[model samples]
Target: MPYPSSDTPAANPSPADSRAARLWEALPGLSYGADYNPEQWPEDIRRQDVELMKEAGVTVLSVGIFSWAWLEPSEGRYDFAWLDGVLDSLADAGIKVALATATAAPPAWLVLKHPEILPVAADGTTLGPGSRRHYSPSSSVYRRYAARMTRALADRYGDHPALALWHVDNELGCHISEYYGPEDAEAFRGWLRRRYGSIEALNDAWGTAFWSQRYGGFAEVQPPAPAPTTLNPTQQLDFQRFSSWALIDFYNMLAAVIHEVTPDVPTTTNLMASSATKSMDYFSWAKDLDVIANDHYLVAADTERHIELAFSADLTRGIADGKPWMLMEHSTSAVNWQPRNLPKLPGEMARNSLAHVARGSDAVMFFQWRQSRQGSEKFHSAMVPHDGTATRVWREVVELGAALKALAQVQGSRVESRTAIIFDYEAWWASELDSHPSQDVKYLTLLRAFHRELFLRGITADLVQPGADLSGYSLILVCTLYTVTDAAAANIAAAAERGATVLVSYFSGIVDQHDAVRLGGYPGAFRELLGINSEEFHPLPQHGTVGLDNGWKGRIWSENVRLAGAEAVVSFTGHPLAGVPALTRRVVGSGAAWYLATFPDDTSLAGLLDSLLAESGVAAPATAPAGVELTRRLGAGGASFLFVINHTGAEADVAASGRELVTGTQFSGVVQPGAVAVIVEDAPGGQPG
Candidate 1:
């Protein structure tokens, strides 16, 4: 089968889909590669690397990521001889290149000459150089230097035969993400001035009058710096937003340089572990990129690793608007940074890579091509381990590469879902701020609870922002949305009017984007749509539980809700808020809105979601056992590819029969532990037996 071309036009979708379709139309086949730093190895070793690249079926390599010092040994001095050789060698081996600007890390000489470029912490301590990503995003000196270097590199290699993509400044906002230096303070103040005309308006928006934190002028307004006591939460939240934008501006600078030099070359910066960090708002950053790329590492501490991986991948795909994205970096096995550093069980790595591909990743890549004997990530697994091709990691690397070849037909496909969960960065930052009614009122906790239940049912939901177009979805979940805007509320209302069932959880719509309480009772903007009014919040003690009349227990939070036009689906039992609605549903125009005033346990949440799914006429594609994840990708040519991944330690079965593309066998029954089954659709799934 021929791979989809970069010029294939897609059918009509929403406006967002059209923008995403343009991106998808520029990407052709699945890119299988790794980040190769041939600068680390000797001449002979570099030559041998090409053979290993071919052996592992590597098609692309991201070179010169951290080679800033090597590329420019001294001020105004150039040394592209090594990189020129590496690029030429890779081209000779039929491997493409995602060339880096090599400006992510400045050399020691530059850092020493311009020490003001180093980042500072909230406590006003300047971070010394030695580590990567230490430059302040707002530093003028750093920006000038980085931009000049980026321009030179782009101009030199813009038309290189091996150049396939341009990777702008590696992993923006990873380490030293938020800077609080003098330069950053000035930049933050400028950002605030542009946002609010004067200090008085800023004071009012920050609600600084209550704590006597009112700013006398723009100079008085500083980022939420460390103090003896608790800093103002709203100020800190705004600073976080400013810091993210500053870093984004840093990325945009390099991107501008690259675009001016090489307009046709697509550019992207790897967004790292968004599920774990809320430093950067990816939704805003996604708009700036020609292609969206992400680096996802498993949270070793989480017991349900697969679920978290799926959530992150699905979220990344959603950020791409179901367009093909690049899995820029992932470990082949054990990552060195985690405390435990547990090696993945056999076949686990393959399963994890395929999970990303199943979601929407057109490219599957790892961090490093060869293991490092030095540096901070020496122990991190690589495609070619220190033991070379004689190791298990190498074997699995070859196997996964071959599997990707066989699954090339899945390229340019998109995952379609009738369900979507609102994952907002502003809400996450606002809800996690100090001084919430309950300390446990988290954004991801509630989101994952609902998402895990849907995952178990073999249902895939698109993770979207609160204000995204929901007309394409049948069921939409807004969980722990403490901060909401009028436009977002209107979008939800419109979706409900269009016959979509919108389910909202506790602590939603309680505050605006400014972090001010939405007066006129709780759930300010959504009161009319949800058909419920909340009076007061009853935050339970830690590890507390409240029994409900529907044989379910509520945890973490419960609210005093009075029904307006909605009917109570679940009421509190034997509590102070007895007979008051814990969960209520109301019909709004053509659709329905259900509000849960308290957090429900797994069983209760699952039961509630099942009812919501049934009411919306949404069902799983097939009946699969627990620990088995099933998702489908639809190609532009009307081909459907189903991925079944069994993440358990034992065998599990799915009720669908197809030709298992991975093993080239007819699979009808069971899949072994840590196994993945890629099935090209021959018959409709979930058909009546």
Candidate 2:
């Protein structure tokens, strides 16, 4: 469903139709726990896990995620004795269960029987069953067996008291997002026939006239396989869309069975909604889910990874339409995937968990409850490490759980933001295609840079879809939105014309949804709103930088911009486009529009953002020292909660009046180094006084 417009407020959930609300009502406080894998351990260890969960205030556990093989060792055979004991034990311990369908990994027996279910790479190599997620997304045989398994689980456990939610296949499309096998080709053709309705429409949409690539019929089309040279950009883009749709279709298939069996139980799949996981367009999939859940792991190489964490959490909240989401999976410490795999610093785990909660995550969970003794992820951090409960990780986990319980009132609250940044997964797929102005022009890079500036200044911004309601926002930032629909472009322009401060970065509005150029000049769709036109692009060398008249440096990109009605705010100094405007502003009806033609240095971008925020009348919740991250959440009856996270070594003072929930005392507006605080403000309104 399209998001609610400014005039239409999002509907509040009721007991009759909202399984998410039902699940939360069943739980005691804010949900806390991890993915519990009892199949990997013995009965004694499983009993010990129940005790530890109670001690740590764990309200829920995701079980049977990768237990398909254990549940069904052979074809048409079943073994539910062990799972029955596990679920009964969890229920006795008062822990809710997000029971999985256990279809993430097909059993070895099924794969051995049907080798055609395996996924094939673009290079025609078959991915075997040695790893997880090895099945082709479009395989009917795989879907048949998966649906059977889902039905069996739902039939047995649908009415179980411990079942709070139904977890769909684990992290759909985490690996093998695209397949090139015969089955995939057939499915692709069927999807195309349904989408375009005719072969001629497909040819026109893909612009196949170039290079004699026009398709005579849907049967002749295939996945964008490797060729002698670069494949058609539109074909590749369509394949990306098809791949995501295939996974969504698979998920919907299983969700249908669950809904039929248990109409009141919520169903969700963990989505990787971070910068690192970009294959899936989560916004398109959000409406199908009963609750939104996301998995995010920090990049070990980045020094300021916490900012990236905030970005991911905020993006997840945006996908949920400002509703509270679930932190489905995040490592407690170091992860084994990155090259270095450095362990997190002391107190970083608590800070990370609270940051997500501050950004609208109602539940806090980890990838696994106990560290594995042997596996690819054996070295990955978990709640219980190899050294046992005496470790710092365990202590912090218990402490974070108590903190969440104290802040239980924040569960249904919503994060407050008046500024929005347009984010589109299709645009991300198209912007970084084989041919572009610069390879350094990454969609996430520009997004992170802009978001980091706002983070540093203690401002909150929602990462919204291109077609989302823009009238509710005071400021809108469109960064590297290379491909957009004509309706979306008109919506953004209309927002600017109605008193919103709009900023358009370089390379946006250059193409349509079909990957075809908009025609005429650069940024064709936004020319009238921006009041500027660019004739040509001037991407700088890999290491080159150009001087700007504002005493800043521009890197990677510059354009020969011509002013139609906008006033020049900054210009290039000594390049081929010297004296041409690098930044320009124009007054649209009651508002203003700004255009940036090049990438600016951090200082320069920060200054420009400051001016934009001021002009938009958007300000931080409170003035605080550097390294203090502040966020606010609003609840019913004018209740407000302020989250203050101090990442610096020195003490920081934020101007606020409230009762701190963590320490259960009156807040003095002073936070200690490396500490986190959640305060219930005394003020009636959600905003700071």
Candidate 3:
């Protein structure tokens, strides 16, 4: 039931734990297939389709993803007769059901029956509801129906062997949180009481005196009205926190119902990437989930950069502490949501799938299985296409399935490497929320500067959680951590003391968890680690960055940095803020801490990071070169799966001595444009020989 639609809860992992044991048993040869619906097809077609799935070795079926209408045809009169039959059919075929809540969208019957479930928009316009995820997350009536519907389904089929996993209310966080509805206001008041205990505490934390946001009572507090320009920072941040917690509560309620009824079966909700429209505190829910799986879909070949997508994949892995996770939904050839839906050519799909495995994905699966006969996701790609498995996409899916089955134990295997990238969510939330020198200066921009260099150098950098232990890795990178938390700062300090080389960027540690400014200079919480006292940071436009004390020309927005114990490794040529130390290095026990004052463009960032990593004795993949991306996974064979991805527009030479997993033929030259090869080797082979 779990792996591939992955398993094993984070925060606790041991073979002795019953749930952990079940999850572990389920993970080996764990298979994933998207929601399958042949309900609309003829009997003969349905008959053959069932046989195909078994032949393909598909073990998990995400059933009834969009079957709201079929399950509840009338108000209070559920009709699971069809779904019962579908489950029976799949059970006969040895497939496990990741049951859907069927309330992603209420049936037209429910909407027509109770139109009050419709939600209002932020601009104060009532949206005429006839869509999925239309009810405000805080709507009482919607909650009643959702809970009732889920409980009924669970009670009905909880004991069924085919009923393996419960997917409660798909992608629970959608669009954004409620802002205008009456239900939202009520929920916000309740949440305030729970969070701050009373209006007085809330007032103190929000610093309500500045703009008279102080409330007389919990009931008196309402979601603040955004100004014609922008909402006040205190109010805005509270709202963001409120909204994220609001969705999490909804998911918790749904998961609770399932756990109460069928504790044996695993339960999970699909998580979206950080770029998601809704921001839920996943770190808070990581332990609550059966498995922390996400739908990661960022991809690029020759048209865009690979570093962005690669970082995304790494974050998904880090979400569950490198405990194997799933790629819940993917497009076979091309995706529907992007600005340009570019079909993956030749080896791209296989390459990307292996890359996820290289990162930490247990299984890869598509969004919708049947290629939706109706609805918005009808165009979404799947393993078995709309036209059936005759297409090139189907062949690729079959090939991938075969490969995964052959490599049965690879799903839950851990990847071993000497490089790691540190991402702090507080840092991410803090930097952007800080009312500072530049709102445009973001955590992502600095991360790109740091990771781009690693990608260019062919290093499989682990995207690690902020508080993760870094004693194993040779280097730990902290880039533009704007909101450095006390716990995270301690981890970095400890890592530095443990002899790890850390790279920190400007805008690091400027604020606290509440998005409040840290008082002592800039980078308040983390000032001591880098041994630099930063004063005012001037936001530099493109031209403001120029030559530094080092040979490389500093690019991107430059910050005016001040120093104390740490000296400038890279400095300005000859200008105000020039000799102020653009880059500084400090000794923290046995480790070294390097801080960058600004985000540098690709050329400069790569140059500086490469120099630092080389000096630290970190190793790079042998086949990697400029524009040739490399990812590796260490396996039981003492073999490392080295993935070579060429992001350039032209072919590049790549030399490998051992076997190439993608191609049977041997290679010892440049890798072509978009060429992906998984070469198995021993111990990274001493860095490209």
Candidate 4:
């Protein structure tokens, strides 16, 4: 099979694609609004919502997200009177609608009738339908009902003047990503037959010969459910793949109906694309979505949560192939899901929303419009808090709306970066499997740390897929990619050979796509390109650290690395494997390949990245204080927008001159503390300095 590349033309559509073009034509400006659940409110309150939405400068709203029961009170019965009124009211108020198919949750009647549609956990616990996303991804009965609901929606609203896009379903793979029910087992076998083609091929790929797990036929295989002991790692990996594909397959089934009914209208589904969401390989799903949209919420526990938001936004932009994407949901204040949902401080909401815009998002929206009076998400913050429009959240929502309106020209712009970070969802799933050399080797640990360092340095990096075209990137960072296809490995090596600086971290390139070890040595795929090989891993205990010859501390991992044809940049100072190279650099043509055999502390990692940046000539967009974040988005005719976010307590000075979109004033490069600015550069050439 060919390695998946994000650069594949068919997978990533251009900004001028008809779907994106139609979306822009419908919304006309930077979109602002939330998930509007008028079904939960009375007609009087629904009328009040339009008035408030107009005042807030909301241009769009996602309607009928959880309205399955409301749409159809009983099986084979339908009602669209309430939804008709809602859409008409929004249209009268000049707000567009991303009308949902209303199949996120099955109604009580449908689920009660076909209980097998519910998802079963790995331990055989069936999840009921009280919560959203309760249906199994592979349930044929569920898909049939969902398709019918979708057709009903598209048929009714296909020609509605207010319809902008067809929201296929709510956040997919959110609560119930995997299922182990009878339906899922049958679906998994069918998917395996399609993927492997033959039982012999399946056995070969799974390496089932080990532990007597080989199968006589595809029927003998099953989901990696509860077992007597440790289950097969390959089986677990394949199940993850199958679960993700099943959801996409389900999405396609609904999308096809929408296309058939309303071929002109674009269709999309909100994806949980942040670091917290790992169940779906969104890169694979991006091809199916007419426009990429994602939901992100700040982790209340993380002090630097905004950095994580930037990372997520950047990754989403990468999934969109550098095109503008939509931020379907975020929060105006505190979210109900976290253990301790902390309310946003004054101006924090604007900063959060604009941070996403600064990265690549063309629209900024939230999870809900009005605060729920009663439900599981009653406490979840919204555009209108329980205190009505008199609260801080409401004021911020209005202010954010006005700000987005002022920055309307920033839409359709693209964030450009010469540095690329290789991010693979399958690799993330495979590397974090059980029984690894170290449990501390988390998939996102290194990527997040490195992205934070880059953010602090004001250097924007694109999260590219493994098999993507790498020749354009001046610097490529491959961190802990334990599983990779041979084609992807060759692509990275080719990038380095073509004078692109490449960095490969520890435990990478150890296994093939099938989770089988490469025959030669550790980091087997890139050993020749990296000019190094390791015989074994030396993972440290919890909270343990190792010293390096360069005075850096290595934690969580160390390796018995031996330089094959490269020079050691840093070596282990002492231990059972004393004087071993901790870091090595190999000169390949005009470029260099650097290898880190262990994880370094933050300060050391920053220093090493600084060195790499200097060597590769990748500099920050502008000079600013440590806490200020800078990113640039380029548009047509050599136009650029500079986004400066100051997270520090003290005001900072940056070397930039432009008309600030946030304040509508000429910026002299001075930014106030805890504020955000999007500056439109005055110069004709918008290249970053």
**Local accuracy of candidate 2 as per-residue lDDT tens digits, 1-689:** 12332224347755323787787787656799999999999999999999999999999999999999999999879999999999999999999999999999999999999999999999999999988998987899999999999999999999998999999999999876989999999999999999899999999999888999988888899888879998999889988999999999999999999999999999999999988887899999998888999999999889899999999998998899888789989999999989899999999999999999999899999988999999899999999999999999999999998999998878787788888999999999999999788998999877789999999878888999988988788899999999999999999999898999999999999999999998889888999899898999999999788888989887878989999999999999994887999999999988899999888888888888989999999888888997899998877766778899998999999998888998899898899999998888877554432
Rank by lDDT, descending?
2, 4, 1, 3
Clashing pairs in 2: none
User: What's the lDDT for residue 111 in model 2?
Assistant: 92
* Ten contiguous residues minimizing lDDT sum, candidate 2: 1-10
The better candidate by TM-score, 1 or 2, is: 2
Off by over 4 Å in 4: 1-16, 684-689
Error of 4 at 685 (Å): 9.1
Scored by CA lDDT, what does every candidate get? 0.85, 0.90, 0.69, 0.89
Every model's TM-score: 0.95, 0.97, 0.90, 0.97
Clashing pairs in 4: none
Candidate 2 has a TM-score of 0.97
- Candidate 3 per-residue lDDT over residues 82-106, each given as its tens digit: 7787788888888777787776777
Give the per-residue lDDT of model 1 (tens digit) for 1-689.
11232336645644434534443443346778899988788999998998888988898888899999998899899899989999988888878888998878889999989999999998888988788988998999999999998998998898888887888889998876788889999999999999999888899888988778887889988878767777787788889889889988988899889878876677888887456878888888888877789999987777888888889998998787667888999989999998899888788899889999988899999988999989998999899898988889899999999999888778887776889999899999989888779888888998988889988888998898887878788899999988999999899888988999999888999888898888898788899999889999998999999989989989999989998889999999766888989999999888999999888888888889889999998777767788789998877546667899988888887776767777777776788887888887665454311
Off by over 4 Å in 2: 1-17, 684-689
Clash count list over all predictions: 0, 0, 13, 0
* Span of ten consecutive residues with least summed lDDT in model 4: 1-10
